[model samples]
Target: MSEAPLAARPPAQQDPLPAAWPDHLRALPALIEAAGLVSFDFFDTLFIRPLADAEDAFDILGESRGIADFRARRRAAQAGAFRVMQQEKRGEIDLDGIYRCFDGLPDAAAVRDAEYALEQEITLPNPEMIAVFRAALAQGKPVVVTSDMYLRAPWFTALMRRHGLPEVPLFISADRDCTKRDFGALFDLLSAETGVPKERILHIGDNAASDIGKARERGLVAFHYREPRLPPRCKGISPAASLARALIRNHQQEVPPGSLRELGFQKGGPAALGFLDWIAGAARRDGIEHILFVSRDGHILRRMAEQVRPEALPPSSYLLGSRVAFTLAAMTPANFESHLPFLLSGADGLSPAELLARIDVPAPGASVLRDLGLGPETRFRHDQPEPMRGLLKAWRWEILKIARRNRRGLLRHLLELGLRPGQRVALVDVGWNGTTQEAFVAALRGLMPLDVTGYYFCLADSEDARRRRALMPMESLVGPDSVSPGMLAAIHANRVAAEFFFSAPHDPVIGYRDDAGGVVAVEDPGRAPTDGIQAMARELEEGMLDFARHHTGWTRRLGLRADPLGLAMPLLEEMADGSWADHSGLRLVRNFDSWASSANHTMWLTDYAARP
Candidate 1:
């Protein structure tokens, strides 16, 4: 049956013409009141798939389970199914039909199940269109869903009810085995079922061609609700109901929200929540009693925990520490060789005087290096270790003597900062090989004989990690080598981005000294960070804290737990792929020196692309 030839009623006299694009959705309620019947497109109208595209669900289903190039394969399967359906004169292909045409049918059923789950996960209620849906019902107009979608009636109705959408008649093209392309056959069926003429019906949807043009073809007044543009890094992954959205919406309510704050709220905050949740769970599983948030990366993390510690999480302390601080304080005549690499890491192209200063070798002790046939101005690179190592070794004792004195002061500082003899502690940082943990352990050798576990954001999976794994327990929140490897690898290649995210607003802790008999941080008198970086840092900090506060309230309200990691994966994937290089806040992260390597921040995205 085809729609009867009819002329659509003009828009309501009380309501002005609907605005263009995004504003059209908001103006839809007035149009609904003008009609005897209101038709809504199922997807991207009443609800949305908060993914890059409708097909992105297939990629998520396949990639999340480590199926390589699953999206490409899934796309091929769907195209093949469509071709088969065309030959058979079939309607929109259902999920099962697409899978039946799938290559490697052995895994088809499993992947299909995953596809259903991912669809369920990514689906979101379009709040503005939902308002239109409510208005239609409120006007006593007959409301119905008309769509050319694969999802059948039962599941579609189920989804509507699940999201609090009122029960109404649905006219699905797939159910009738006729699509919108069938010249209003689907709309005629809707008119027949609802007993409302096509001319008096008002339709609202996202697609201009399928929803607007087709409804107009059916003599129904159509309103186009165009999707809004997402933020720079948020493209392809911004879920409408996510914490990132919540933060963005909240920030927009403020007088003005900067990109820096939005970055933390949308990207860093969710990532941090995911990592923190993982860390807390791991710590509890390992029976850890106390967690140490090692400086300077842990500053924001520590504050987040303080603001929102999940129920019964282990006690935490913001431990004042760094690789150079712990390594220099722990180094002795016997272990100076082992600590030498960290000392000379960024010291390659400088004179002995500059190198001595870089390595934290004190004034008088560094002067002892001149006696070993190497003047204060002698240039030696650590990479060519043969001559430089020999010269450094010739006077290692004197340099270490000064280092040993600092070690005593550090022990006192650590004690004052709350390290004890036998505490079951864990060291936390934005991770890689657990070098800080190793140095921290060595620093406490005489003072605490403590065997502390290391909890990193991502373990480097290197020789150092393997060696340290034998010495003490270790766990990583993110896996570059294992779980979520693709996303994590993108994250790894852009590790500089993570450093940029967690950059702090304070000078780094260089060393410790006695202050009125109590140990205090002996920070450098000239504490210089990249100019303008701290403004971004403070904004990121505020945004992250804001997320933590809201996250606590939301999880508590929902009762059924939301996946923090799931919220983070989308933003992180963009980061891994270098999409965040455009963020203005990240650009301020210059000369970011971490893990003893210094480089321009956010430049790694280009550098990584050039590799191989």
Candidate 2:
């Protein structure tokens, strides 16, 4: 294949040209002028890893090949190989020699070959450093590349050529049988062979001890390359997470303004990826039989899961679910008080009729309120539990009839949907209080003996969720002690964004319907998405899935098993109420009546929105 010119390539993929010397290298030009020979460290300085660690190569190999603990095994093999080579007084340890120590291994050659392929695939050329290298050559100074890696000299040469590195001398440890660390070993050979005095040679690399300290001791001037990395955008982020943000920044260069794909790729993708991986691992660990991603948030989640979920993890199915469907279906006249907290979520300090209307009450509604001795506009506050309980009592029969009908249909829906009695299942959702999970529990009570667990993206009011811990096995990505209070706050503050991004482009489910062939989710047409929100949602979901697939591809190719949640925080934080991001399309998203209860009023996520 022919190479695309950097100028014509997407900004994200284009490397910096020779004119790209920045502040860090302001001193380099003078150093290059003074030196007769410029020696660059090959791995960190020239070839770079998108992954966080070198051992990750072994981990990826193990996962792909189905080998157990290959990282540890590979490390042990290298150590053993080095020790044996030292005892034998052979030259420096090399790749072939290391594999020889991997005893009793079938397809050792394949493993070795796979590792080599991974090493090459994972490493990319450092654009800025490549520019510095070209500048050194342009100045007519002799140059060479040095590396202490165990790969073959020819392989290294080919890698250099492919990356457009000048075909200069190589002082590789495996090839030269001496390393830069071996007290004056490779340096002595380099100085003598190149006929450049040690005082006039300049060495540059990332390792402070080896590249700077050791080289200066050998009478060569050294520059600690200090290879650049994106800083942690949020607290407790990993290097891999930081790199994820860097990847997004690179991606945004070409992305259009208000691109839903960028938003999903930046925030939603990582969130789903992390949450899905966490739940998949948890399901596998807990021996879960199947996972039901509760709708409509699960609409996007179910699609993203296939990209990152472990094969050993149980299969997943999407449950046509909603707060209204689950909560209302599971309600009873006697337990109306039990479900009052959820039903009255949008009714704090509001009219009693407001709650009834949200739950869809019919005949005698206005007149029934009068007969019950409570007017239509009667005030009800969250603090007035007594009044609320009294109101629920007056309308118990009317509500119970609807609840029972909803319950019957919802139960039939589940049974027809392939979930039966006695199955170990997990309920996955973009969570707050594990409400749907609990509702599923209540709806299935007496009908089925299924074991159900709940996995949420986050938990709100952790203390409240903890209070119900005795009732169900529930887990969250950002909840309780798992994350700092600050992170939890950020997550809570951005609930609207979370809901908007993950929500399916459909109406909210009020209950299930028994159609001729199967049970279909009955949606509240009143709560249906507007054409604008629906269109944006479709694009958002498309972008989110796009990100999932691209992320899977990039991470797998680089042998990085990324922390999806930690990596997601940077973009999520930027999208928060007050951050650097413009939040153009996001600002147009309407705030929801929590759980689709109460009045379905729409409020734009603009100045009226809450802030952290």
How well does model 2 score by local distance difference test? 0.70
lDDT of 2 at 596: 36
Alpha-carbon RMSD of each model: 9.0, 8.4
Error of 1 at 75 (Å): 20
TM-score of each: 0.63, 0.62
- Which residue pairs come into collision in candidate 2? none
Error of 2 at 327 (Å): 2.6
Off by over 4 Å in 2: 1-120, 123-243, 249-258, 306-312, 348-354, 363-366, 369-392, 493-496, 525-531, 562-565, 568-582, 594-602, 606-612
lDDT of 1 by residue, 1-612 (tens): 233222233322332322441443566656766788888887866777534356645544554567767777878888988998899987677778888988775667877876665666556666656655665555556677788877677767667668765667777876787777557677767777667778877877777787878778988788887655333333343222243444443234331344677677767887777777777878878888888888778888888887787463687888776776787788887777886666566554455544555444543345556555566555666657555566557658767765776687777765766667787888888877777888888788776776599888776645777788788788776664445656655666667667666656765665666678676654431212345656767888787777767765645533324454565564566566787776655655653453332221222223332111
lDDT against the true structure, each candidate: 0.65, 0.70
TM-score of 2: 0.62
Best by TM-score: 1
